[model samples]
Target: MNNEEYVFAPDDFVLAGNDHDAFIDDTYFKQSYWKDMLSRFTKNKGAVVGLFVIFLIILMAIIGPGLNEYTYDFQTISHQNLAPRIELLEPLGIFDGSETMSTSTGMVEINKYVSEDGSLTGLEDTYYWFGTDVLGRDIFTRTWEGTRISLYIALVAVAVDMLFGMSYGLISGYFGGRVDMVMQRISEIINGIPTLVMVTLLIIVMKPGLGTITLALAIRGWIGMSRIARAQVLKLKEQEFILATKTLGAKDFFIIFKEILPNIFGQLIIMSMFSVPNAIFTEAFLAFVGLGVPQPLASLGSLISDAFKSFTTHPYMIIFPVIVLALIMLSFNLLADGMRDAFDPKMKEM
Candidate 1:
């Protein structure tokens, strides 16, 4: 065609210099709600640090027990009531060669039971890094071991909530009639009794141990999750997509599990996060009251209970467990808060 004949018409579509199409809008990233939520969550410095702390605690719980030479139950009166000592710190002049810790009562040292001549009376091979209990069990090993048990209980409790509780509420609320009323009534009956009283009764009947503690926590644990799930399902079931799926002949189970469950995962997960710390605390309390794991099988609460006798003399025993429990509970709280902010649109707006 001649150049003059090829003159652009008024309605001719003109191309930019580049041939590639720019179909994606420049504002797409800005409009992404999920991406912006994540950015906002990461900006919360406390949450990020809390996440890191949790990772370290988990790592310690997994690997720390094995690294120490002493077993959690290993005990000897010969080396009883030793104090925390870092050999490396000795070289730095921060700690002397002796295992001595400054306490509110007085300066406490390792009770090696030396004679007046200054010779080792206890077994020479064993070393207590974080000190020892009255029974001479290694505190460092016991601490990590207790951490393992506590984390395990929390994990199992959270799983019970997410699995059974989530399913129960989904089924009940989706059905929305007799099933809902019956299921909700059951949950309410369980909720009617105080957790402490029910757990106490269960403990007496079932025999107090790790298994009993886990069972009690799980039995009551799902109540919160079920309530949350029911509310979420109540809202979700009213949406147009859910109505459309029902009209399309989707089975109740399929609709609830496949469609509804995935949509409410964020809320469910947030509930699970909050549940973990609560479960951990309950286990600790049960153990403290002598209804948790039996003797020789250390847990954070049991360790604290054991220390109660000589707590004034050997406060480190109480202090260490308290610190670990505090760390775990606080970390989960921060993580839950972060996740809520990251997943909830309303929080992202703030």
Candidate 2:
């Protein structure tokens, strides 16, 4: 009814220049799988902190032993059981080279700088950041050296086990039927034996050193990885892409490694991360039981074992190594959890 004053003017409409280009430019960019996984991983605060802590520990493990003048095995009976002292932190009353002893008058705090006669011992300038062990060796230096050994053992064991597991699982799953059956039975038999028992037997048979420990771990370590890889292969083998690859006459090896492995590699990597902590803990346990690396070559477990006897008198002896071991285990677990969440598509949805 009021159409008399309304008229469409050409000036009211503006030409939209480069609207297609704008749409194209504003479209979301596609990211690669690893890039997406990394983006998700970085979003986890706990995981990021764990990664940073692990990096710091690794850096310290590499350089910490050399920071102080004293070698790990350097002994001085006069310096035995000296409390942790640092020149920088002493002014704050902590790490002031003090030790508490149970005397006839109950507990008495004594300055490391003072001798039995209560006079200056002339060692005020001396510092042992983690004090000294019963053998008068530097605990700080030994701790780092021990960390290095523990890490080495864990990494090497895990690497060896992963290689075996991945290969076994791929072959077993790829060639199903009798091949799968035989492989599964063999793995089951190996897995039936308790890991501790295997390790013990190996220690009894061979020398209880790094190689023995590594071999013992490898014996049963691959079972879990093999199972995981097998399951993944089973699941993926029936997928359309795999069927297509097979139809295309791809070689079995090519199909397994190139087509299938790349698909399941992320899961395998996650499993490997989970296995690291177990390997580390196992090595530490063996070391604690007097089956670890021999003398002059310390591991975190051996260090803890050495400190256990004097723990009642010098609690510091055990504290440092235990703390380091705990941190390493915790950080790896957190990082593994983060990786699992990041790489898993189902978790991404959650």
Which is the leading candidate under TM-score?
A: 2
> Model 1 off-target regions past 4 Å?
1-38, 93-126, 347-350
| Every candidate's lDDT | 0.82, 0.87
Q: Among these predicted structures, which one has the highest lDDT?
A: 2
Deviation from native of the Cα of residue 168 in model 2, angstroms: 0.9
What ranges in model 2 sit over 4 Å off?
A: 1-29, 116-120, 345-350
Q: Model 2 over residues 208-324: C-alpha lDDT tens digits?
A: 788888888777888889998998899888899989988999999999999999888888888888888888998899899888888878899999999999988899999999999
For candidate 2, the lDDT comes to: 0.87
Deviation (Å) of 151 in candidate 1: 0.6
lDDT of 1 by residue, 1-350 (tens): 55665567876886576733465567763347677877978987878988999999999999988987789988877667876655667557542325456678887664443344678665444456677888888888999999999899879978999888988888888888998999999999987887678778987798778888777777778888988888889989989998899899999899898999999898899889988898899888878888779888999999888888778667777888889999999999998888888888574464
The alpha-carbon RMSD values of the candidates against the true structure, listed in the order shown, are: 4.0, 4.4
TM-scores of all predicted structures: 0.86, 0.89
